[model samples]
Target chain A: MRNIWTICRKELGGYFVSPIAYLLLTMFALIFGFFFWNILGYFVNEGMEMIMRGETVPMNLNEQIIRPLLSNVSVIGLFFIPMITMRLFAEEKRSGTIELLATSPIRDIEIILGKWLSAVILYSCLLLLTALNFGFLFLYGKPDWKPLLVGYLGLLLQGGLLLAVGTFISTLTKNQIIAGAATFGICLLLWVIEWVTGYESATWATVLAYFSVITHFDSFARGVIDSKDLVFYLTGIFLGLFATARSMESLRWRS
Target chain B: MRVLTCFLPPSAGTATVAGFDVLEQPREVKRRIGYLPETPPLYPEMATSEYLRFVGKLKGLSGGELEKRVDYVCERCFIADVKQKLLGKLSKGYRQRVGLAQAIIHNPEVLILDEPTAGLDPKQINETRDLIKSLAGDHTIVLSTHILPEVEQICEQVIIINKGKLVATDSVRNLQARTRGVESLQVEVAGRDGSLSYELVQRRLEQVPGVAHVLCRDPHEHRLIFEVQSQKGQLTRGDLARAVVESGWDLNELRAASMSLEEIFLELTGSDAPKETAELTKEMQA
Candidate 1:
């Protein structure tokens, strides 16, 4: 546990010292803020028109603005998670620092978890920064914070799952660009796999749709935390981390 | 080196470091060994002190001891001046020193340094060599280098590996002694009258017991230089001196030309080694 924490702290400290962390933080905040502004503007305009027509329809901020905003954050993550994760193993290998880590007394699992945890923390910090924008919504509007919390939870699980995948791909190569691109490709595929169900509702299509990240994320976006979706995200994250552990083990001999 | 350091598992064999199996008890082996790859593993963004602290922590040092060890290694490696500087901004020599400091931080039982002085200036090389020599008896240093002279000077035991196979492993003294048995003595002799006959001298020298071959070399000034090869386990110097004096020739110089580590390395590793030299290497391996 000490070894894992040592590695985690080192990796976390690494992110802050390099420009990569600030670059990622600013970019995520900017893009998410743009989506937040555009979505809220549209929601307000719709509410005003309903009021001018003197209709008694209630405004649902959670459904109208928050759901799409959370969904867009997941989409933005498809681009940024790879950038955050591509360097975990690839940079270590390229700079020959993997030798130090490999030869150290720490277990392979500890090293893997430490790096993945740091990546998660960095991504979470980005999520936390965007929470400031959510604070403004809370100050003026009465959108139930319950659904917003669930939406953020869904986004974290989905992002964590993709980060784990990116962590595995990062171990496959020493080139960070290749690792990032491969992670992006794999994440995008997971996002769009539900499209096949739209055309054909066959059994295989249903299975593919079940595998789609968006299919599970939709429930959380709508303020419902389905047990099956939670299980799916958790299991997917475990498998990704399991695959990363296997890759780390192979590195002992494959080199 | 990687296999021994617990970095990479061997394909078909098992190794132990400090009585710990690399495959079954890798953490134990790792705990006792400090490894420095050809390129030192460093993060560019880390300050030297921060990096050393991290390595010490990874090696199981904590609290005041870790802090003290970090300061000691910093002073020992001559990088105290750059302790606050980021590794990326330091020069190559300073970086190598920092790499070395990390390896010695926990003061493990074994230190594996590959090309420790590879990119350093001459002064730093000497300082690094002195530091390694200073740490010799207390720590088991497995220094891997391509510089033969460095091996000849710093190492007590030398293990020569050729094509991933053990070629020779012996004390530096013992390996250097390979220059002696069946050795060739360079003898420069001249006739007393400032003239000499190469044929006559060669004939007289070959008559000495245990002398294998006497090949005449070019005359230098007034002396005829002959490389008198001796048979295995024979020291023909006394008999040769007597024979040259009896033949009425002035013996100017007679000394064994010791073989260098480079020559021994080549003889053992070279594909085209002479028959006798190849046998010598095989004998050493045995």
Candidate 2:
């Protein structure tokens, strides 16, 4: 545990020391805030229209605004998660510090956990930035805080799963650009894997749709947390991290 | 060195350091070994002291123990002045020293250095050598370098591997002495008037007792030079000088030529097969 934390701290330091972390944070906030402002504007206008029509059913703020914002944060993460994990192992290999780590007394699992944990933490910080916008909704209106927390939890699980995949890809090469591009490609593919279910109803099609990251995330976005979706995100995270460990082990033997 | 350091696994067989099997117990092996790869493994974004502390933590040092060793190594490696400087901005010499410092920060039993002074200026190389020499009392140091003098200077027990095969393993003095079975003498002589040909001088030296071969070399100013090889355990310096003086030739220079480690390294790791190397090592041991 101590070893993992040390590596995680160093990795977090790596991110914060470079311009990449700040740039990613800023761009993500700018894009997420844009989406939030536009959605909130649309929600308020729709509520006024409902009032004007004498259909006085209270508009659901959670459904109309926060859910789409959380979903957009996941989309924004598709770009930023790749950036967060690109340098994790790639830069270490490029600069030859991987030798230092590889030859150290730490286990491969510890190193992997440390690095992946840091990526998850950085992603959390990005999610925390979106919380400021979420704060606005609470001050002006009453949305169930419980559902908002559940939505953020789902987002965290989904981001953790994808970041694990990115960590695995980062271990495959010494080039950060290749790692980043490959990670983005794989993340996008996983996001869109459910598209196959649209035209086919075969068993394999159902299986493919089941593997889509967005499919499992839909329930949580609806302000509901099912054990099935929780299991899916947890299993996805385990598999991604498992694959990363195997990649790291193979690299030791190959080199 | 990489194999011993647990960086690269061996294709076959295994190795043990400090009674720990590298393949079977890598973490245990790692705990007792300090390795410095050819390039100093450094994070450019980290300051020198911070990097040391980080490496120290990875090596399993905690709190006060880690900080004390960090300070000790920084002072020992002569990087104390640059402790706060970012590693990327530091000079190569300081970077190399920091690499060395990190390796020894944990104070492991075995210190494996791969060409530790490969790319340093003459002064820095000497300083680094002195630091390594000072470290010899506390740790069993394993240093590899293409600079023959470095091995002759710093190392005690030497292992030479050529193309991934063990060429020879012995002490520096033993390798030198083993190659001295057949001794060569550098003899420079000429007539009192500087008229004697090198060929004539070479023939005269060949006639000396115990001389196995004589080769004539170019004249050194007024003196003709001859390299005379004598059989094993022979001392023909006196005979060669007497023969030159008896022939009315002026003996300008006569000195025993010691085989340098560079020459012995080339001879051992050369095209010689493993069979010949094994035989040579066997003969040396005998």
| Local error of candidate 2 at residue A210 (angstroms) | 0.9
Model 1 Cα lDDT, one tens digit per residue, A84-175: 99999999999999999988888888999899899999999999987998889889988899998999999899988999999999999999
Over B155-200, each residue of candidate 1 has an lDDT whose tens digit, in order, gives 8778877656778888877987874566788998878786566888
Query: Which predicted model would earn the best DockQ?
Result: 2
Model 1's CAPRI class is medium
Q: Which residue runs does candidate 1 get wrong by more than 4 Å?
A: B119-121, B182-256, B271-286
iRMS per model, in Å, is 0.8, 0.9
- Candidate 2 wrongly placed segments (more than 4 Å): A51-55, B190-196, B207-210, B219-223, B236-252, B271-286
Recovery fraction of native interface contacts for candidate 1: 0.94
lDDT of 2 at B2: 78
Model 1 residue A197 CA deviation (Å) reads 1.7
Show the colliding residue pairs in model 1: none
